[model samples]
Target chain A: MGTNPVPNKKLAIFTATGCRACENAILDIHYQVSSLARCADIAFWPYMLGSEVRDLEKQESIDVCFFAGAIRTSSDREAALKLREKSRIMVACGACAAFGGMPGLVNISQWSVVSGQSQRTMDNKQQTNEEEKPELPPLESRVLGLPQIVKVDYLVPGCPPTQNFLWAAIQSLVCNGQSPARLSFAASRLPEAIAQAITSGILPPKGSIFAGEKAVCASCSRVKEEKRFETYKRPYQAYEELGRCLLEQGLVCQGITTQEGCGGLCTAMGQPCRGCFGKAEAIFDPGAKMVSAISSTFDSNDAQEIAALVDDIVDLVGTFYRYTLPTQCALFSTPSKD
Target chain B: MSDFEPKIIAFLCTWCAYVAADTAGIARYKQKPNVRVIRVLCSGMVDPNYVLKAFASGADAVLVGGCHPGDCHYISGNIKAMRRAPLLRKLLEEMGVENGRFRLEWIAASDAPQYAEIINQMSEEVRSLGPFSPSTIK
Candidate 1:
């Protein structure tokens, strides 16, 4: 047993229909890419190395599998199931894998209806012959995050997870002898010395979030005054005022209900949070919790007035559950009986 | 359609709505028998998840009852519930849950007649709306 010694950790990267950003995140690790390459053998990465699924299946076991993308089709689901089974630790990478990402908004309507509508639009616009049209696989009834289909040991939360967080997670597992209970970018926002000091401590319980326990509002720099709003404004409808809370200014910033981990980057830049990080601890549904927060800020308790205020929000599902519709407990999709 | 009976899950505030239900029974007020009630300490305590869970678990409709705004035993608990009610309705509407399947009413402890009226009226409305479909729970 001692003869072989220094067993290399085998790593696999799986991406399904996700933006190329996930692949870029791996490359963006800069000089660490060499260290990562040295420490872990890249067993399979379909996007970069053009490895086949059969290659992954042939591996005895994968030490870590980094999966990115929502499971949108039958093939995606099949790949996710296979990768999950082959890996010892499966890390759901990026917003698409951890939550459902923007694609989850498709849950508002049936898949057939969505596909049919698109088909009709293409038919009218192009007037293409049947042979000219490219065939697309049938979409699953609902988009699903990785954890929805199989167990996920870790989540790297970002549109495409930041290279620092990805590197930190990999470094810890390779060198520290244990993965951090939860690995998030919250600490990465701090000065490098402080971030390192904070992360070096004992970790929280397993399954705990790697992000800040508080809502994004706690870390946000906006001034908070009375939260009364008579009307809501869409991001495009009005110019945001500087140094004021977006919600107080009548914009539906979801920071009050969203977990803090993105370093309030969007809010700092005067844009409302889209809640890509999912719910804070103890919150089952980020959308519902946001509804409670926004509704409570209304100036009136009268039903009609409240309804009027809510009407200002265009596309309620997209506004509330934009990034999290798939994993939310209150939102589920089942095949129709008919 | 006429034979359809709606199943309603009523979350009654312990201080007011629950007492009102007790008073309705004592006074022998005629009310719809389709309602099943769960009492909570305050209407403010009704997490929106409970209402969603009730609907998802196959209740045809959900009714949340709280004290009249100013009369809440916890000062502004009913007002808090009032604020949350419309938001919950908006969420339900977005999920394609039909109108009248979820309602919130303010009932004082003394208002047994009003309680009975709301239950009967909700039951009738939900009966016309038909059984809650599982697919719309999302």
Candidate 2:
């Protein structure tokens, strides 16, 4: 391990929605907390400290800012923009920030359908002239990842990145004077200082992913044989046999198309991959690519028969674009008319 | 409206449909000139992205041509393509694309007249449906 030339660099941790896990991830540093504290100053952390948005805005700059959550609303976008302005290196710190997470599945339905009920309820309450309430910020029609709104230097992708990977990122930044390679998912989107490294060929290509080059199936520990499925099975419908590939058994495991990360943890635990790590290299639409791959594996050739086989999938959009709907090409819809 | 000419993207499988297209040309079969044929190795090789991209980039309709069952050069490539067609159509429908904008047909190498007929029918159908405005999608 190397040492930082300038210690006590300022750090910020910004949370939006689904960020409770990242809050815990900070303490997950555990015994190494002291080591982290010794090198960098926690200049701002809204959840753990008294610092507010105004306080963060007051700072001239921060060495690193870890933003966790999907940009579902205007406020989230505001925070992301503010943090981007203040931080030298911005990291999208969780799945919600990296790939839109579970919230992105809302992309399947029309934007009005997803948010209309709440808007109607709010309108009804306002009409009653009850106690004064703070005006709510408008929501974006689509749930977007941090990178969709602002330049993100790194992405620590997981529902909450594993504690070990989190520590390695901090250690590499503080101890080695460089960001961890595993955390450099969107290095091309970095600001001047970091982008220069890629432009000058010191770092890897601009859009190089920090994780393993292969798809999750390459790292999966299950026994995979020739794949041919007569029917699709949802996880809740059956007991999956141990050590057998979930996809080979007709469960829609996304391992074959998902970028490798999280050590194939969900697959190891007998559940299919939800594709939170996003598409593998050379893949543009994670959902469509998986759909194509899965479709190719079906046993039948008759269009009616294949449609019947596919009809078994309860929610096509939810199943395929579980975490990546916002960025999926086929799901792109025009903005709401309202 | 009467002069509406649809812009069609026809993905022709090299072993069967491409040959049929050439035969149609040589035989002087009268077919709609609106269809732009892109020769691919096999219909199974047509990724959904190509179709989606074609629609996104302003194609009025996409026509995928493959070998009839048991006629595929790569053994079961057309079978794989058959399995994929329905799913791709379903996905397109979910995205709010109008029905009949995508068609999958099997054209044998010797069936030049049939190939010309299908293209003419598809061109007429897509023309009636009008231009595909994917404005709802970004």
Candidate 3:
């Protein structure tokens, strides 16, 4: 993606508050990046290939912009609004941008999280006598999804989006929705759904999330057996065979409400669904739906038993609303026309 | 605070709390008449989003009243509510909502006087707590 940052149809990427895994996800598209690059230019990605602050300050309109972080600080909001102003199509690319992702957990408390980290940094600095790092810009009280701050045309929903699906999205956008005559070779290298999506060449309407409409369970290869919620298993604890569904084994799988389209990537690897792909279509509150789904599935109806079933759920908010919490303000805050 | 009347949105379970409120009305009980009730088939029917929506849409507070733990009409709907309430409360608190702004209680069908008393108490408590600004929600 960075090898030749020549100017063509302008494409820009902006990071506000994220781990930069999404940038790595784009890089993981490997050789396909060059083919996509042939169609467009990398206008202002400051992450890998360096760009001066003045270079971004003088930036003009862009064809497509991928914003990959939650709007945390005033600077982040300014960047988002600026990106919205300059881009023809703005995509929230990754869970942080689309639904607040890991960074949103800091909203648990405005002061404590940031202060705790800064305090730790102080301790580390004292130990090493290291040169002072640049201080971060002050955070807004809440983390916000891209859609909340400004209108977003599309969302690539994932902690870091699935590589093949991301490729398909870029290629489709580059081709202007028509399947390229030269896709069979690349399609053969992708997953079936991504291959079909690229080959079929139908552009979804604006504001569509680039993920499956159904829950991640639909794409998971694991067999669903009995839902015996006897105990909640922590990540460090031993788990059952990879063949069986992780949710049925009481591992806090969020597939029931999480949108698929990562091709069940984590679940396929025996990890439970963390709902990084935002709420599946038609679901309102991802956490509440998950609570209802799992609470009802417990083997025993006894109060103490149910509590026991949930006792191991250390971070209920993180487990269920890890990616969707920032989106919750839109879920119910506005009065519905009931 | 004397003139501050709280706007409460109650999601009452049809089997228990809804009927209790009806009986409170028929029995001529003295209650603070502030709550706008949306009767659900079961307490479990009220997703956390509904409570958030109620507060977001200008309500001062939200109360979710249902059957007692073992008395659920759906055998286990109230049990599910039990599991969700505390965590939902924590989530709301994280979003800058005060914990007292949400109340989860059990109201039996025959507990008309009790229902009236609870309503009066919640209304008075919220009135003292002052109006909740919806702008702080986001």
The best candidate by DockQ is 1
Flag regions of model 3 displaced more than 4 Å: A1-8, A57-60, A111-135, A175-179, A182-203, A305-311, A329-338, B68-76, B79-101, B133-138
Model 2, B1-138: lDDT tens per residue? 888889999999999999999999999999999998999999989988889878877899999999998989999888888888887787777767767989889999999999999999988988888888655432
Off by over 4 Å in 2: A1-5, A17-19, A112-115, A127-129, A132-134, A174-208, A328-338, B1-5, B128-130, B133-135
Which lDDT tens digits does candidate 2 get at residues A100-128? 77787666567778679768878887888
Clashes of 1: 0
- How far off is residue A22 in model 1, in Å? 2.7
Ranking the candidates on lDDT from highest down gives 1, 2, 3
How high a TM-score does candidate 1 get? 0.84
Candidate 2 RMSD to the correct structure: 5.2
- How good is model 3 by TM-score? 0.83
How many residue pairs clash (N, CA or C atoms closer than 3 angstroms) in each of the candidate models, in the order given? 0, 1, 0
Query: Which ranges in model 1 have alpha carbons more than 4 Å from their true place?
Result: A1-5, A115-133, A174-210, A237-241, A301-303, A333-338, B1-5, B73-75, B136-138
DockQ of each: 0.52, 0.46, 0.32
Query: Under CAPRI classification, how is model 1 graded?
Result: medium
Model 2 residue A101 lDDT score: 76
Q: Could you say which candidate leads in lDDT?
A: 1
